[model samples]
Target: MSLTVRILIGLALGLASGIALAEWGAAWEADAVAIAQPVGKAWLGGLQMPLIPLIFALLVTGITQAAATARGNRIAGRAIALFAMLLLAAASAAALAGPLL
Candidate 1:
């Protein structure tokens, strides 16, 4: 079988196992403290293992490109301002609708 098929099968098996465990009692149920805690910690550790090098590489490449551009500062400033304005607008809308819900 293909790699995609194998990955899908693994995902399906994982989902089925999770559902079965959830249906059992607390002792059998895969709660955060029981099953997920260690798994989550290990997964996070694996993800963070190469994060520093990846971040440094990305930052160096970004800075080099930005320095090479004539209008990079202006573009970055406008992007930041637009993002802030959109974020504020979203927060204001959510606040206004919170009471109605």
Candidate 2:
């Protein structure tokens, strides 16, 4: 199946199993945590280890291209302006709603 569907299925199964274990598997909880903790940490570390350098590379590449385009292209500049405004608006909305959440 597609990656998206596989991810959704995994998410649903995880949620269901978590709830089942929480409700009826108290005896297995300690063993489950012991098994899951190291695995989860390793998974998270695998995901995170390359993120900083990847993000820095992407940002450098994106800014270089954007600056070059925005310098001579009015349309690109205007589009970038609109993008920035929307980004700021989204951030502001998130900040305002964060406390309520």
Candidate 3:
């Protein structure tokens, strides 16, 4: 009923369908990849279309708001740390998963 539940259901279904396709679509894998890959990329590009501007807007807003208070420095530090940690975690996951894949 909620957005989170819907997203979770979508993720689960996507995974299930992807697994089913991978297992049973071997004969058509090339065609499937040829078609699906571009569609997937287009979907991803659509999703990312607003990301850069949104991030830039948020970053500017944060900087402007933080400039007025001393606590903003601490908040900014924590945000940067969190961002770094997320980047590190992503890199670590890619590093670990690359060999397996």
Candidate 4:
């Protein structure tokens, strides 16, 4: 079978097992807590581990590239101007909605 089929089967099996455990109050239920909670925490930690360096690398690369290209400042300025316009539009919409409610 293909990988997609295998993944779907695994998800179905997992859902079935979870429902069975919930019904039976089995060891699998307890194991789910023990396994899932720490694994989830560790997975989140793993994700966070690379975030700072990745963000810094991306930012530095972007800035360096922008500096090298003359249009970087203009692009950044336009982005800021567009963001300010959107913020003002959002605020105005909210203000108009508040009085109607």
TM-score for all models, in order of appearance = 0.49, 0.51, 0.47, 0.57
Better of 1 and 3 by TM-score: 1
Give the top-scoring candidate (TM-score).
Answer: 4
lDDT of 4 by residue, 1-101 (tens): 99999999999999998788788897567766997898898898798666555655565566557756876777755655665566567667866996699
Q: How far is each candidate from the true structure, as Cα RMSD in Å?
A: 8.4, 7.9, 8.0, 9.6
User: Tens digit of lDDT per residue, candidate 3, span 17-94?
Assistant: 999988887787888789989899889879966765576557656765775575677767666566556656766787
Model 4, residue 26: C-alpha shift (Å): 1.8
- TM-score between model 4 and native: 0.57
Candidate 2 Cα misplacement greater than 4 A, ranges: 1-10, 66-101
For 1-101, candidate 2 gives per-residue lDDT tens digits of 99999999999999998998888889869998999899998898799667655654565567658878667456555655665676567667876996698
Q: How do the residues 1-101 of candidate 1 rate in per-residue lDDT, one tens digit apiece?
A: 99999999999999997787677746645455677788987897799667555654565566557745855776655655665566567667866996699
Off by over 4 Å in 4: 71-101
Point out the worst 10-residue segment of candidate 1 by lDDT.
Answer: 24-33
